[model samples]
Target: MNERNSASNNGLTSLSLIGDAAEVGISPSVQQARLPFTVRVVADDEALARALAVRQKAYMRHVPDFASTMHIPEKYDREEGGLVLLAEAKLTGSPVGTMRIQTNRFRPLAIEQSIDLPSWLSGRMVGATRLAVEAGGPGRMVKAALFKAFYLYCVNQGIEWMVIAARTPLDRQYAALLFRDVFGVGEFIPLAHAANIPHRIMAFEVGTAERRWREAGHPLHEFMVATHHPDIDLSAAPSLAWPGTSVDLQIPADPADINSGAGNAVRRQPACTL
Candidate 1:
């Protein structure tokens, strides 16, 4: 995680550094200046908690003990030294989606294995977790945007791989990113470290990830993951860098939103492995 933070900070000091695709692309037309929204990394604990609250509420709506907070900052963010990206309504400053990317050391799977992996499998890669978006996600655009920030980091870090432990079971979604399932495995999440509740082991190779995204056909989101999870395959289902990964999402009503007078955005499919 420290590596990620250091690399990102270093990019600021050295402006000549090559970063994300967005930076390379030609500027959008002036009329396009109207903000669709704004994205930023959570530099403070409060913002982190607010982002976690959104996801926690979603998890607990079904499995009561499943989740109640974004506990990474309290327990792991500092020690692990990863990064947290937040997307908010540019107009209201309401955090809408979030994803956490950290140095490979934060993955529970590797830690539980107690077996060290080669630099290619671990050091050359990072781990992405706790990805969540608000109800009306615009086919998950906000989540995709936050992911892009991580990709930019990878480009600067020169990292070559990515690993993820999913709880939501989003295989088809991930597969679209060329994240084929790598065969080997490692996993364990003691209660002492339970944040999103249950965590699973998953991984992906950069080439595979790039291929998946290139193939998934969601160009904007594809581009986002490419920069955020660059080591990830943009065109493959699951991934080859480590193991298969996916996410499960179900719709639930949030009293907070209801009180503000908005209904649940949409009724979603069950938390399937899909």
Candidate 2:
């Protein structure tokens, strides 16, 4: 894998530097928040494989049948308008969480494959899918951090709506974040992309998220807007990076060369056994 040097270097800034804080009107001192794991865009095949491994493991616990098909990368993972985020433990350099964000830039969102989005929702939409985190207390933090990354990515990309298809209890989680249903309230529709499973389609307005959270006294509001997380790096992702700049993606020629350290975007941490 051939590494893109510029992407790796430019990706190190904290989330506080990515967007204008004055727009929200409640900028605190913006304290830096550090975690035991680093979340970043999967820039190479090796990172993608690690993300897939964690994805399959997380799915197997709840959806073993569906997990069977997740061992390999899906077509959506490689699509031009999409980028996969991978969270790796700082200790072992092992993937702890993963999420894929797909924009309706060149094509329709994967969720659209299952149902048509209402005409009322328009302009620069993104769907977050394949969210999975390692099990345990740390996993909870990883899930939240991944979401913060998702939200930050949307902000940087000028995305209007952040959409998702959640099932059962997961739908409740999104609700807690103030995400509203696209259809009728609590309505679950069968999604073709999700193995025909019934899921409630929900959407979040990216621009108004901070204001809504602050107004509703949302618990995660401080963590989402007031704190800065340097570990959640979206600058490596061409589609999500700083506005106006573009970089051509280069995928490794051989999938078997997983051990090749070339083109890796994962930040090196202190070595430790898993």
Candidate 3:
């Protein structure tokens, strides 16, 4: 894959689905939508700590043992080509959700430690991990928003595929988003990345997401494609610097105004509430 230097003049990447909607058979006009919370890339030590707090709390509900180790930032959280996203309540500024995205641009994906990817799965890939969200109705929205943020990040970085290793039941949620199993149909393999817990490896093609979602009459089709979410901000995100280089990720000093409704004419939707 060639290096993708598609950052705008102000140094922030734009979502490809939003930029090339017509090509994917989606409406160019996006409806402006708002959530009770804001999703953004974790840029400072305090932000990361808040993210870890939510992560640990979310995990404590299921995997108490693993949750114990999650209070502190993981090594991958600060690695090159990897970034953590945090969702915070607009009213309280408390973390509600978080996810870590790791790309194969700099090193083998964390998933690669367990199984060798098929040759057909080659090319620019990103793996979503450590996905954790608070419980309840609002948490559901936060989880969905975080997934959208992950998809947007992949599209912005010119990623070919979005990959994840999910355990049972939780994997079903990804299936609803149209991710397909990479290994076998309904096959769960032990993943070292998840503390040897069995998980189904799934992948979604980033380049084809818009087309696929539209074709399937997906429930989130409008939300994912035609909705302008100013709350899901990635302007402070570190640029996908040179490929194959061990350069550290750094947020731009003056990131682009991604929330600016430039080409997108919008209709305001009611703000979401918990």
Candidate 4:
């Protein structure tokens, strides 16, 4: 009778442990809920237009002078070594947010025009620009989803560093995301490529992003590294650089839209990942 009781207690203990784990939301299936929107590569001119609209709308609220000319897609949108990501509402198909990513595979990064990068950051770099999202709850979520896509793209392309020039207030959020200043901390550099705006240049190490966040106990650590976000789609993304080297060089015509909004104007508070 005691042997049977011990077996029964063992079974109960196993069931109780599983129940406890479930309560803590340990399963990926439980944590991996769907996002209200989906972020994907801008496939064609039409999709690019939608992304541009989102950019203009979000920027106009803060920087009307720059946003006025953003009605159409920028030259980088069609560039060989660059791509634009768009987050669209799954229910309404409206563009919720957008971010433009360009690499230095063929030419130097846009920020290079302003300041020279150190030897460590000279190669295999991806820069993000024109990041904007609608002003609301959906906008916050869209920004997080877009960043996940950015991180995944960098990983797939073997990008060493992710760089960006952010304006005031936005720079603080970037700091929270584990982005360190490439130059002097808290010093804003005037980026000629970004309309001579005094913006802070920040970079995130792609290879060490997961480990750094985990070690630091970052708030978005789980959302970034642990959770599997299916809403971020990179299927149509152009390959910027491979694991070991840069791809074949392709120089497009100098369409002359390079010096656009690097320091995009958005008034939204930095939410989940910013």
> What TM-score would every model get versus the actual structure?
0.56, 0.77, 0.79, 0.77
Residues 204-260 of candidate 2: C-alpha lDDT, one tens digit per residue: 987778778778865566557665566677667664332333422122233211112
Stretches off by above 4 angstroms in model 4 are 1-31, 241-274
Off by over 4 Å in 2: 1-30, 240-274
Report the candidate with higher lDDT, 1 versus 2.
Answer: 2
Worst 10 residues of 1 by lDDT: 9-18
Q: Give me the runs in candidate 1 sitting further than 4 Å from their true place.
A: 1-35, 69-73, 105-120, 184-200, 207-222, 225-274
Q: Lowest-scoring 10 consecutive residues by lDDT in candidate 4? A: 257-266
User: What is the Cα-based TM-score of model 2?
Assistant: 0.77
Task: Give candidate 4's error at residue 124 in angstroms.
Answer: 0.4
Question: How many residue pairs collide in each prediction?
Answer: 46, 1, 0, 0
Cα lDDT tens digits, model 4, 177-201, are: 7899988988899888778889998
In what order do the candidates fall by TM-score, top score first?
A: 3, 4, 2, 1
User: Which model scores highest in lDDT?
Assistant: 3
lDDT of 1 at 119: 48
lDDT of 1 by residue, 56-137 (tens): 6555555566464434354444444466666677667777766767665335443334334444465456777667767642
Q: Estimate every model's Cα lDDT from 0 to 1.
A: 0.44, 0.71, 0.71, 0.67
Task: State, as a TM-score between 0 and 1, how close model 1 is to the true structure.
Answer: 0.56
